[model samples]
Structure formats: structure tokens, C-alpha cells
Target: MGTLTTTGRARSVGALFAGVALLNTATVGLSTAATLIVAAGSGPGWSGLPSVANVLGTAAGALGAGLLLPVHGRRRVLSAGYAVAAAGALVAFAGALTTSLVPLLLGILLVGLGNGGAQLSRYLAADLYPEERRGRALSNVVWAGTVGALAGPALMAPAADVATGFGWPALSGPVAVAVLATAGAALAAAFLPRHVPVRQEVPVRAPARATGVARPLVAMVAAQLTMVAVMTMTPVQLENHGHGLDVVGWVLSAHLFGMFALAPLSGRIADRWGPRVTVNAGLGVLALSTATALAAPTAHTSGLPVALFLLGYGWNLVFVGGSAQLSRDLAPETRSRVQGTVDAVVWSASALAGLGSGQLFAGGGYALVAVVGGVLALLPLALLASRNGR
Candidate 1:
């Protein structure tokens, strides 16, 4: 409405976008450990702490995110979430060193809290831009995280080895990674500019109307949860097929590369196709990919790579699709609260998937895990699609 060209606004908004995405490095560090730790043979009982971490972090994050609406504001909470989660990472590393499962779990739960709060980072892009430009901003934030996620595992191996050389378990990897990611928070608080002012031009919509606006947002969030739930856990599942780390890593990198590489384009797809179309199409593709991953659990042939690679590719589409939609779904009056609620729930759902995946995989093989998991995951997407982009 003012003198700012849309391009100029996006340029300014991109800084905040980078901050939010950079903070996603925490997810890379934490989730890498979250999924891999379960495969570490850290006693069956202890193997699940990472899952518990996901759940607990997300639950608290859901609540704590509400706090950002009023007191600290998004910038403060985003910055603080990174720093605080860094502490949790330290605690987790300490726990990993001592092999103290309870404390390890607690520390990760705190990471979950940090993650919960950090979920708002993507929303920041939504806050800074207008509805028309929202998709690109959201995609930019995600693409930033994609780079960090790729690096996270590479960094984890060295940190883990260092921890082992010091007569400690390798869990210190995530802790070290957490610290690295926390620096982003410091940068955010220092360099990220505030662009959105505190006033609204119209009377606020009721929760009912806001919720109506958020329907696609919620659907997209669900799509995101399903995507992360499977893609994040794929390496562990592949490892079960007796695939070596080399094989798993190759496939995972391919998967991540597929997702990360396509993020910017995915946003363009959303921008052109309409958010609803993008979300639905992406989820549909994701549903097919998830089913393929479930059906073929290994890259024994290039087929496995092709299928799982497609899974990651499809996940990129849906996740970015959903994220872009959320960024544009609501008005400023409801921005903080609605965005917080959406992210908290999305992450909480992801946590549940990670936590439950372990039990599902342990009780059953990867095939059963795939079949059951695929069915469970399909429900949300099916419901979302049933509405046909409303």
C-alpha cells in the first residue's frame, strides 16, 4: 500500500526469510539424531528417546508458540528458540556421553520445545510479505533449511566421531550441531529487520472465519507431517534392509537432494497453480511416493533408488506446497496465533510419526511398517484431496 515495490519488500523480507530457514539447521541436527539414534542400538528402551524428544518438544512448542504471540514477539521467540534449543542440544550431548537415557530424553524434549518455538521461523516470511508474494517467501525459508539439512548429517558424523574418541557415545553429534545452528538465532536477532507494523486495517475475523481460512493451511501442515515422517525416517528403514550406511547415505542424500533441489521450483508451482492446487497436487504426489517407499524398502536395484528418490522428490513438492499455502492463508490480526497453532500441530504430528514409527518397525518389519504407515499417512491427504482444493 505504500511506496515499497513488491520486489523491494521481498528483498527486505528475504533477510528474515534466511534467518528462519537457517534456524532449520536445528531440525537437521536434531532429526538426524532423532532418526539415527534409534538405529544406534542404544538399548531398545533408550532407542525411543529421540522419538519422545520429538513428541515432548512439539507439545511444549505448541504451547510455547502461543507465548510468542504477545510477549517476546516472533523475532525474540525465534531467536530465543534457537539459543535455548542449543542448550537442550548440549544437555542431550551430555546425556549421550554419559549414556544416561533419562536425561538424554529430557534434553531432547527440550530440543523439541526449541523446535516447537522454532517452527514459527517459516511464518516470519508470511508476516513480512503480502498474500500474493507469500509462496515465494515461504519457499525461500524452506530452501534455506534444505541446505542446512544436507550439511547436518555430514557434520554429525565428525562430531560423533569426536565424541567417541573422547570415550563418549556419539550422541554428542546432535549437541554440536545444535550449537552450530544456534548461531543463526544470534544472527536473526542482530541482523533480521522488522518490517511488519502492529496495526490491522479491518476489524479482526472471528476464530471461526480464521479457521475457515486456515483449512488449506491445516491440510498442507498435515501433508508436511506425513512427508517428514517418512522421508526423515527412510535411512533407518533402509538400514533395516541390511543396506550399509554407504547405501543408506547414498539414497538419503539423493532423497534430500531431490527435495532440496526442487524447493524454489515448488514455490513457483504454488505461485502459478494456486496454493490449493499446489498443496493437493504435492500431497497426491507424496502419497504415491510414500506408498512406493513402503512397498520397496531398499535400493537393491536402481528401482529402490528411483522409488525412494521419488518419495523425497514428492515430499519436496507437498511440503513446500503446504508451507506456501500457510503463509498466505490468514490475515495479520490472526497471524501469530494461527501460524503458531499450525506449526505446533504439524511438528507434533511429525513427532508422533517418528515415535510411533519405531514401535511399528520394531513390532513389524519395514514392509509391514510401510503398509501400515502408508495407510495411516494417506488418510490426511485423502481427506484434504476429497475437498478438491475447496
Candidate 2:
């Protein structure tokens, strides 16, 4: 591949940022709407199914992207991913119109696959910059999600109203919004440069040394598992406590803000302090956030929002840090495949967490879920500590 000019790189990154922002909007809106649709129709016991399907779809998409990106190039792969997601959203809209669970789940699953592809855009961004600035570059894409943080849930009422006006299900409106947003993302992705400059390979010395990948991989999986488990149950928890959809939206907005608004800071931290320190700080914060959740009152409480926000930021730290670490020193040949495989594992684990959170909440309430999350956070911390001691 030819060397890309700085200006060209900047343009590509800008396109990716736009694409990511749109994808996040679609994802957030779909997730929120799907949860409510399922919960109302099938009861809260099955509310987590949407999330599980979404994450599993993401895992499949990511794995597919990883395998394809090396062969097809970034522009085509990413654009196609968004296109798939848009189609999935339309299917979900149909499901909402008919009040059908199977199609709804399938649609959400397809949306997740597209998300898996969209999420890999961060790696593409990293490819545009040198190692020294890779974290910041990658984070800029992650930060684009801040737009979705505000717009996704904020659009729910207006979108629903618009759908109802047309004699469609109110819940179908958000899925319609998702269809548009992902289509926009596909257009944005088409603007990405066809190729990125490949970095030099850093040789792996031994099997033991290659084990270094485990550190970041484990950190990411732990973070994803904890975040998904807690987040999947949060809306249900709030609703059970007599809070309304409006309240759930507000709390989710806050949490999404925490997840994306501070991405640049997380990137900077990963670049300057190294992934180890960043991951440690994230795990600590996660523990603290889960602890706060333990004390949330049955009635509406500011504490829930605070804890959820903390949970989000904590997840961001680990996610960015681990991503930065994982991107370092890989041969260009395997980069996309490695990233895709790692994300597949992370999202797959999160799917399980999503599935289990509902059951745990049903049996023991939110407290059990929170406690499990806190324990997950601590286990990674202990692993890091033991490694450092060695």
C-alpha cells in the first residue's frame, strides 16, 4: 500500500468518527426500545434477550470483519457492516409493528453484527497514526459516541410520537431511527480511505512472551462482562422501583455520557501511563461503582445515576487501555484478525453476562447483580497484582 498523507489520514479519521457516532446512536436507540418492547410483551424475565442477541451478533460481526478486512480493505468492509445493520434495523421495525419476538430478536442480532464491524473502526483509526499517538487517535473515534449518548435516548419520545402518527407501533419508531442512522453510517464509512499504512512488525520472542496479550485481553473481557451485566439489569431495576421510562432514559443518558465523554482522557492515560496502570485504575473504579449500587434505595435515587455513570467511565478506561495495549507491536498481517478475535471474545462474554444478569436479578434482585460485578472487578485486580509481584 502507498503511504497516506497526513491530510488524507485526517479526512479518513473524520469519516470514521462520523460513522461511529451514527452507529452508536442506532445501537443505543435500538437497545433501549428493544428492551422495553420485550419487557412489556413477554415480561421483564426475558428483557435481557435483546441484549444477548445484540452482543452475540456483534461477536459474529467482529469476527467476520477481522477475517474480511485483511482481504477486502477497510472502506468496503465497514460500509458493508453498516449496511447490514441498517437492514437489521428495518427488520426490527417490522417486528415491532407486528409484535413478534422472533423477528425482533433476529433483527437485534443483526444490528449487533453491524455494531461489531463499526466498533472495529477504532482499530482503523489507530492504523492512521503512529504508535505514540495511536491511543488518542483510537479514542477520538470512541469519543464520537458522545453524540449518540445525548441523541439516542433523547430521540425516543419524538421518534415514537412520529411512528404512532403513522399508525405504527411506538416502539418501532426508534428502530426506524436506527435504520436511518446506520444508513448514514454506511455513507460516512464509504468516505474512508481505501487503505492505511501498515506498521512494522514487532517479533514475538517466545510462547511465554506472547502471553502478554492475555493481560489486555483479560482486562477487556472483565470490564465488558461487568459493564454488560450491570447495565443490562439497570433499566429493569429502575422500573421495578417505580421509575418511569423517562427516568430510565435520563439514567442511561448519564451512563452513556460517562462511557464516551472522557474517552480522550482515557486515551491520554493509556498512552502516557501505560495500559497496566490504566486497567488497574479502571478495575478500582468499577469496584467502587458496584459498591455504590449496593446502597441504592428501592425508590428513585440519585445514587443509581452516579453509580451507573461511574460504571460507564470505568468500562471506558479498561476498554481504551486494553485496546491500546492490544494494538501495540503486531504484524500488519494479523492485526485485524487479532482485534476481531479479541472483540469476539469480549462481546461473547458480555452476552453471557447479559443473559445471567436477568436471572440473577430475578432470583436475588439488583443487589446480587451488583455484588457479582464487584467480585468480577476484584478478580482482575488480584490477577494484576499477582503478576506484578512475580
Candidate 3:
């Protein structure tokens, strides 16, 4: 594999970062708003439905992208996804206006679908660079989400104010923001360069068996499962403990910050130490974070925020590392299908976690959820250990 020219690389990376940032910003904002809406309209126990729908949408989008990218190419597929996301934003906003749970859920599901496609940016970036630099490329695109994640919730105040002035529901503001952001991302994607780097050329070597993808895929699934299981309920927990929406926003922002802010550093770590090591390290961090949250006496305590932040950070590390390892191990000719399948499975597991997280929290409490998550976090470690021993 050859290096991409500096200018070419920069242009491609910048475009990807911009598109990813916009979509992520919308997704995060929608996530917060959707949960609140569903909780108020339905019950706290059902809050996770929107997120579950979102992840399901993402899963569908990932699979669809896999099928489309090889035929229609990245730009067309990405732009279409954004367009669909924008439409979903409108649907969600309408749900807020009508105070109907159905529309809100439907809207979120569509947004999730769009987000699923946007998630492919990392894969695209990975393909654009040489193997040695693939981690950095992927992480850089992921890091772009830091901007969106932090700014997304901050926009809520103004959006709500505007919605109030317009006689619309408060939640409508954030969905509106999502619409504009996703539309902008769609426009940005439309201009992306179609020519991927020469490094993406499939090698002539005989491909390894598909079973080689299972290890990293499992790691990816475990990481996402634990992360979603905990994250989807954090806001509900805080609100239940008397914290206002503002505090929830801030806490979630912190968590999102952790998810994206240090992506570059994580990528570097993966490159330096190997993805397996990074994945293992992530699992440890997740376990510690969950235990900390479990140990906290109250939801209002400082431990919750700290735990959420570390949880997000741990998830980021594992996701990036596992993604790198998976990408590196697969043959380019079969990469798209394999990546799509693995992501679908991982996201499907996350979807299940999102669906069950609220019920778990309602039935048992955060401690029960955290303990279960901690146990799941350890599975990848055990698998990794077994693989190493073999």
C-alpha cells in the first residue's frame, strides 16, 4: 500500500470529518431529546425504545451501506442517508408537536438509520490510508464528533427558546437543529472525492478464512453492548434523582466528550501497542467505571458523571481498536461485506441492550445494570486470553 499525497489525504480527511461531525451532532441531540420525550409520553421504563429504534436503524443503515457502497459508491449512499435523516428530524419534530409517542419513536428510528450509514465514515477513512496510518485516519474522523457532541446539547437552550416563541413543543427545537445539521452534512458529503487512495487496492494474496473476523467482532459487540446498556439510562437516572434537564445535558455532554475527545490518542495507542492491547485496556476501564457507578450511594453524587465519562472513554478505545484490528485482518476484496456483517451484529446486540436497559433499571436499579455490564465487559477479556493462549 502506498501513501496518499498530503493534499489528497487532507482534503479527503477534512471532508469526512466535517460530514461525520454534523451527523454526530444531530444524532447526539436527537438521542437526548428522544429519550426525554418518550419518558414523558410513555414511562421511564420505555425511554430506551427510542434508542433501541435508533440502534436498529443504524444496523439497517450499516447493512444497506454495505450493499450500496460497492455499487453506488460512498458519496451517493452517504448523501442519501443524510437526506433520510433530515426527513426523520421533521417526523420527530412533528411527534413533539402532537405529543404522540409513535411519531417520536418512528422519527428516531429513521435518524438511527441515517446515523448507521454515517458510521461508515471511519471505514472509509481507514480505506483511504495505508495500513500503518489507518488507526490515525479512523480516529481523526471519530474525533471530529467531539465538536458535534459538545455543541449539540448546548444548542438545546436556544432551540427551546425559539420553539417557545413559535408556539411549538420545546423538544421540537433540538429536532429542528438535527434537520439543519443533517442537511448540511448531506451537502458536505455530496462534494466528497470519489477516488479512494491506492492503498485500498485488494492484494493478490489468498484470503484468510472468514472465521478470522470473529474475535475482533466479538470484542466490538461486547464493548458496544456494555456501553449502550449503561449510557441509555444515565439521563433517566439523573432525572429520577431530581436533577434538572440542564444537568442531564451537561452530564451527557461530558460522556459524549469522553467518547470522542481523546480519539486521536486512542488511535495512537492502538498503532503503538497493538489493537488487542487497546481493546483489553478499554475493557478494564469499563469495569472500573461500572464498579464506581455501582459504589455510588446516590445518583446525584459525583460518581455518576465520572462513571459515565469513563464509560464513554472506554467504549471509544475499544471501538477504535477493535475496528482497526478487524480492518487490518480482513482482505480488501471481502472487507465491505465482512465489516457490514460485523457492524450489524454488534449494533444489533447494542440495540438489545438499549431496549433492555430501561427495564433493567426499573426492575432492579443502576447497580444491577452496572454489575451485569461489568460481567459482560469481562467476556472479551476471557476470549482474548483464550485466543492468546491458543
Candidate 4:
């Protein structure tokens, strides 16, 4: 049979990849604002409000995982996620206006579902590409996501300014986010082929062996979990050092810069080195970042930011590795479902870390947080790095 190529397909898979950018913008941007506002407004600080965000985020993620199969197809699932996210944004915005925490939480929860599902954009890109180009193709799609991730938090300042000046609802940020998400989702729905998942939607044929695939999947999940855990705690760690909000914003941006700025190149690296080596290297960087955190002096305030940026580098590396590998392993028939399941596992673990981060910092202080995060970051890699064979 002839190889799969475009012509019958959409003009470019890249065009389809654009949907990921939109989803990332709404999900990441809204998340940034929601967490920040919650941090400021809630009584007990991260100890309380961020937990609400996590709870909502976790709930939404869980729901999305369950709904992925029954929702017609991947596009429909993604569209539904976007709509639910918009609803969440509206409710959250109204909550902020009315000073009702419940509504705000509900809004964030809706966005979280979209966030969870949208994350599978990488896998979608993988499905669109042939084996040879899959890694780079997945990277390009993830790179698109960075546009929104960077913009998301940056948008918050202007939005918060608007709320403060206009005497409108303090939740204007989500309102703006809702608009953007709605438009993007609609566009994605309209543009995406109604029938794209042709081979994908069918039932799967099992792979050669269970143990062979399980190790890599499990390793990738560990890498994902570690990346999220340390990454999540950075802001709180900085706050403990008396860093101001502006500093916090700058630090977060610096980390993103370290991460996505070189992501395209990281993808190239993974494609060349092969996924296993790339992922192992990623875990190494993460371990190094954690070690640095352990050594940072109590008098030094730079630990969190520096560590975050470096840890982000690890994430970039691992992201490229794992994404390509998952596509390689799974049956095309089961790709989206598998992607959803993998994300559910990764996000669910990270949610636990997110939920416990504040208490960890509070109880053990930044030092404990760093050490614990570091160990968790390194343990899985240590277990799997020997990785006898693919």
C-alpha cells in the first residue's frame, strides 16, 4: 500500500495543530488568573484557595477522562471541553463579582476539564504525523501551546487593572478568557474534519507484549509527575522568601522562557537521540535542579526562580521524548482514549502534589519542600534509567 500523505488530508496537519494553541491559551491563561485571584482573595492563602482550584481542576480532569470516548470523537470532546470551560469562566467571573467563592470555584473547575483534555493535543499531533516525523510534529504543536501559556499570565495584569479601574467584577479575567476560549473552540470545531479519527475511532488490536510497553509508560508518567510537583511549588517557595508579586511574575516567566523557548530544539534533540535518552536526560536535569534547591542558602532568595527555570528545562526535554513514544506504542485506533488515560494518570498524580504542596511547604518549610520534590523527581528515573531495552 502507498504511504499516508496529504492531498486527501487537510492542507496541513499544522493547520489542525492551531486548535491546540487556542485550547492552551484559554486553559493556561484562565488557570493563571484563577489561581492568582484565588490566592489573593481567599482567607487562608494557598493553604485554602489554591486547594479549591486543585479540587475543581482535579474534578474537571477526572470528568474529561471519563467523557473522552462517549463524546462522539476527539474534536467533539475537545469542543465540549471548551464550552464547559466557558461556562466555568462565566460562573467564576460572576462569583468574583458577587463575592461568592462557590461560583468562582465552579468556573475554575470547568476550565480545568478543558485544560486536561486540551493537553492531549500533543497526541493528536502525533496521530497526524507519520512515524519518521512524529516527534518533531508533536513538538511544533506543543510550541504552539507556549504562545498561550506565556500570554495567559501576562494577560492577567492588564485584566486585573481593568477590573480595578472600571469597578467591574474582579473576575473580568475569566470573562475575557471565556470569550477567547469560546471563539477558539468554535473555530477548531468548524475547521477540524468531522471525520478525521477514521482509523482512530475503531477498537484496538493489542500490542505484542504488556510488560514491554508498561515500563516506558510508567516511566513517562513518573517524569510527568515529578515535573509537575516541583514546578507547582516554586511560587509558594518564593513567597516564603518574601519575594513580592512582581518578582513572582517575573520568576514564572523566566521558567516558561527556559522551558518553551528551546522546545523546538528539544524536539530535534529527542528525534536524534531517540526518546529514551532524551527522557533520561530530562530526569537528570530535574534531579540537578532539585539538588540545587537543597543547597540554596537560607539567606538566598534566588533558589526558587533558578530552580524553576532549570526544572522547566527538564520538562521540555521529557515532553518531547514521552509524547513521541506514546504515539509509537499505541494502536492508532485507541490513541485518544490512551492519551486521555495517560493524562488522567499524570494529572491525577500532580493534583495530589498540588494539593499537598502548601502543607508541605508550611510544615517542612522550603527546604523540606525542595528535598522532597527533588527525591520524587529523581526516584523514577533512577529506577528506570538502566532501561535494559526498548
Number of the predicted model whose lDDT against the real structure is largest: 2
Clashing pairs in 4: 88-107
Off by over 4 Å in 2: 196-211, 297-301
Candidate 1, residue 5: Cα displacement in angstroms equals 9.6
Q: What is the TM-score of each candidate against the true structure?
A: 0.83, 0.94, 0.93, 0.84
Candidate 2 lDDT over residue span 256-311, tens digit each: 99899999999999899887888889998888888988888353458888888899
- Report the C-alpha lDDT of model 1 over 1-390, residue by residue, as the tens digit: 123466755554565555545555565666556556556755332344476576668657756765454445555665666677667777776766665666667777776776665556556655556677667766766676566546665566677777678776665665666766666655655454443434433544543367444555556455555555565456676666676544654565556666666777878888888766666666566667667766666655665566555666666676666666656666556666665665666666666666666666567655655565456546666566667453
* C-alpha-based local distance difference test score of model 2: 0.85
Candidate 4 Cα misplacement greater than 4 A, ranges = 1-16, 41-71, 168-175, 196-212, 239-244, 294-303
Better of 1 and 2 by TM-score: 2
Cα error of candidate 3 at position 367, Å: 1.9
* Candidate 3 per-residue C-alpha lDDT over 262-370 given as tens digits, one digit per residue, 9 for 90 to 100: 9999999988888888888899888887898898826554888788889889999898898888667777776766677678778888988898898998899878789
* Weakest lDDT window of 10 consecutive positions for candidate 1: 192-201
Clashing residue pairs in all predictions, respectively, total: 2, 0, 0, 1
Question: lDDT per model, in order?
Answer: 0.61, 0.85, 0.81, 0.62
Question: How do all the candidates rank in terms of TM-score, highest first?
Answer: 2, 3, 4, 1
Kindly report which residue pairs in candidate 3 clash with one another: none
RMSD of 3: 3.0
Root-mean-square deviation per candidate: 3.7, 2.6, 3.0, 3.8
lDDT of 3: 0.81
